[model samples]
Structures are given as structure tokens and as C-alpha cells.
Target: MDTGVPLSVAVSVVGKRQNPELVRVAGAGKEKCCYFFWQGRNSTVSEKGTSALMTVELDEERGAQVQVQQGKEPPCFLQCFNGGMIVHSGRREEEEENAQNEWRLYCVRGEVPVEGHLLEVACHCSSLRSRASMILLSVNRAIIYLWHGCKAQPHTRDVGRTAACRIKEQ
Candidate 1:
């Protein structure tokens, strides 16, 4: 499948007490296919942290969506296509502080036919403040890809009098 074209993107962040979530949305039009690569990192004062990378494929014509959520309490949830979900737990904490720092990455590839098209992606990081102290979070980065069709190849030119020119030079 074609990787599609890349476009400019915008990033936003929202922080909440008791419940914290991160959301990202991107897509092409309904007439093509696209793909995306995502990466994420979580940092805190205690020296503990987490990181992940994911890739996704999207079909603009069929309206496909992929959702991923990672946290300490409820584990991680990965949803794709229609009613598909995958759950994973026991992610190794890099340091003592990492147990409180939660992070996840989402990458998608697909096509969108509309110029003003949009997609929604969200992440939530939650843990017991009693067991592990939640420190100041330094979450950053969002990469968006916009499909702009395929690229064209270079053209070649032929010389009609190559043989005559070659003999004269020799």
C-alpha cells in the first residue's frame, strides 16, 4: 500500500486531576490510503518513566479507527477496526519514579479524501497517588501525516544524432 503524502499538523495537551488523558487526531481523505508512525515518552522526578511506539493502517472509504489507552490501574487497551480490542499489562518501570510515569505511542496509516477531514485519538494515564506519588509530568510531541498523493519520477531525453556526433569526436 502507498504510504500517502505528509502534511502539517497541530498538537494540543490537556491535564486533569484524578483522571489524565491525551488525545491526537489525524487523517487523509476518503479516496486514498495513508499510514503514520507514533512515539511517546513519560518523565517524572522519581527517575521512573515509560515509552512506546505503534503503527496503524487506515481506509478512508470505510471509516476505520484505532484507539489506544495506557495506564497503571486499568492496564493498556488497543482498539482497532470494528469492535476489536487488545489488552496488555506488566510494562517494566525503568526506575522507582517510572512506576508513576505512564506513556504510550500511536501511529496510523490511511487515506482521507476530504480536505477538512479529522480523526480522534486519545490516551489516559492514571495511578493510585497513595502507592506511588505522581510527579510533575513532562509529556511532549505529536506527529501528524496528511496524504498528498504520490510523487512523480524524473523524465529522460534521447539524442537523435548520437552516432554521427560520436564518430566526429573520435
Candidate 2:
């Protein structure tokens, strides 16, 4: 979500995909029932409505092992909604700077000619390799480029097309 926009904007945008009644009531502000988890503390929608989107970095070695987190303070705020409740606090996780980039690259992996399997790669020329497929998204230019190395696997074109479609929908 763009911090430049108001929280109300989020409500409106979400209304496009959420329950009509919920969105309408929230917008009307008659009896606001917005609630969600923030950090590790309890938070409410009536709060200052200041938040930022951040990416929590996990160890590559451990892959994606879940860990319990206690409360801490001093970090950017982001409206986080994964599952369960919303808790608001001053706590912040590590920011994923790269996630903020308007340009993104994804390397297509797997040898089965999958339609959407991809591994996100840094948007650098060095990241391009000969044995795989890739997708490049340029939001500023409103363009999507698909590249396939000559020695790439069989599904590069299919995966690129499917992934590009998904990105467009997003």
C-alpha cells in the first residue's frame, strides 16, 4: 500500500474486494468495526491510522521457519493482514528495501514446464542466466518483458505468459 494515500483510501480500495456492507459501514464511520493485528500488540482501526508496508527478512539458510516474536519498538508501520486478528503497536520488523522497487524480476525454475513456478531474482543483468527463464515487470512504463535463454528449459514461454498475467491482475 502507498503511504502517500490515506487509510480511507485503503478502506475504499478494499471495499472493491471485501463485503459491501463492511466497506460501506466503515466509510460511513457511524459504527466503525475495523480491527486487525499489528506487530505483536493490540491495535484498532480508530487509531492514528499511520502505518507502512515493510518486508520481514528471514534467514536464507533456515528457509522459512516460523518463530515466536515478542514486542519491540521503533520501526515503520504497515497494514498487515495475513490471517487472524489485527494488533497495532510501535513495533516494526526489518524492512525489505528491495520489495519497494517498482521493477521486479522473477526467474522461472523447475524442469516440468510449469506454467507459473518462479523464483524472484534481483533486477540486475548479472541475474540473467542461460539455463532458465525469466520475467521482467516495469510498472512505470506499464510493460512486461519475457526473456528465455537459448538453453533454457521447455516452460519458459508458458511460465512467463502466466506470470505476466498474474502480475497484471495484481
Candidate 3:
């Protein structure tokens, strides 16, 4: 789970398979709101209407912080990185508005020693405001459209790449 750079993960198996030590994750005051979506066969989400993939609050608290215990899960050989985003507008409308886009708990990649089974880490957002499409975690009830595997190999090593030039999507 070295999201430091070489990240090309898309492990599946959600809802009851429960292993890898029970698995538990609930950070930042138990979370409140978070949304990041990018699953093909789209329905709608390209009109540039959403943004703020990761931003709990800031002054009120909860900026970005997720933790997952366990270890050993690195073998290299993972080339599926779809990192794209070029959002730039003005920034207003209450900072991309959010009345209840609720989905707390966004970003958790713990114990990824892939081989046979045990892997469920999903978070891919690029048009919610564009920019930073590598590890943008966030979810709640659960909603993963479809992100099979492979076809995103484009690395340069940036580390937490989330840059907003001016902003648009309004």
C-alpha cells in the first residue's frame, strides 16, 4: 500500500469476506462528508458541476487523515494509474456547495499484500473538480460503478498530487 508513488491498485471484494484482521477504519471525528467518483460506463458527472474531493472542513476540523493498521503488502509490479485532472475556474458558490453530499470515510489502503485474496481499497476522482486522480479516497454506504483493472500507467512521482490552478466547474 505504498501510495507514495507506484500506485496502480483496484482490489475488489466488498461486503462480507471480512478478513485481513477484521479491518477497521473511521477517522476524523467519524467523518461527515466526502465524495470522489470516477467509474466508467458513466451516467453523469462530467458537466464540471462538483469539486472538493477531500476536504472535511478545515477551520472546524477534518482536513485529511485516514489510518489502517496491519502491514506487509508490497511486491511492486502494479501499473494501472489513471491520474488526470485539470480543473481551474474561480472558486465560490460556498466552495463548491455541499448541503448533504454525505459519504464520510474516504481514503483507506491498509495491508495490501496481494497474492490470492484480501483487498478492498477504492477511491478515484478526477472530475469532481478535476486534478489529483491517483489516491483521492472517500466513501460511505458504498458505490463503486466499475473500474476493472489496468490502463492508467502514467507515473512521474509527485506525491499527493492535488493542484487547482484557478477553478471552474460551477
Best by lDDT: 2
- Where is model 1 more than 4 Å wrong at Cα? 1-30, 36-79, 91-170
Tell me, by TM-score, which candidate is best. Answer: 2
| lDDT for each residue of candidate 1 in 93-166, tens digit (9 for 90 to 100) | 43345545444322111121111111212233332122211112223322222221123111100111221122
What is the C-alpha lDDT profile of model 3 across 71-98, one tens digit per residue?
A: 3322322112221221211223533464
Error of 2 at 44 (Å): 28
lDDT values for all models? 0.22, 0.44, 0.24
Candidate 2 per-residue C-alpha lDDT over 1-170 given as tens digits, one digit per residue, 9 for 90 to 100: 11111221122223243677776576743322222213223333332243322112212222222211213311111212111112211223323544366776777643333313455566899999987677787777788888888887666666556556666766
In candidate 2, position 62 carries an lDDT of 22
What is the clash tally of candidate 2? 10
Give stretches of model 2 more than 4 Å off. 1-96, 111-115
Ordered list by lDDT, greatest first: 2, 3, 1
Better of 2 and 3 by lDDT: 2
- Give model 3's TM-score versus the native structure: 0.17
Question: Each prediction's TM-score against the native?
Answer: 0.17, 0.39, 0.17
lDDT of model 3 at residue 46? 33
What is the overall TM-score of model 1 with all chains considered together?
0.17
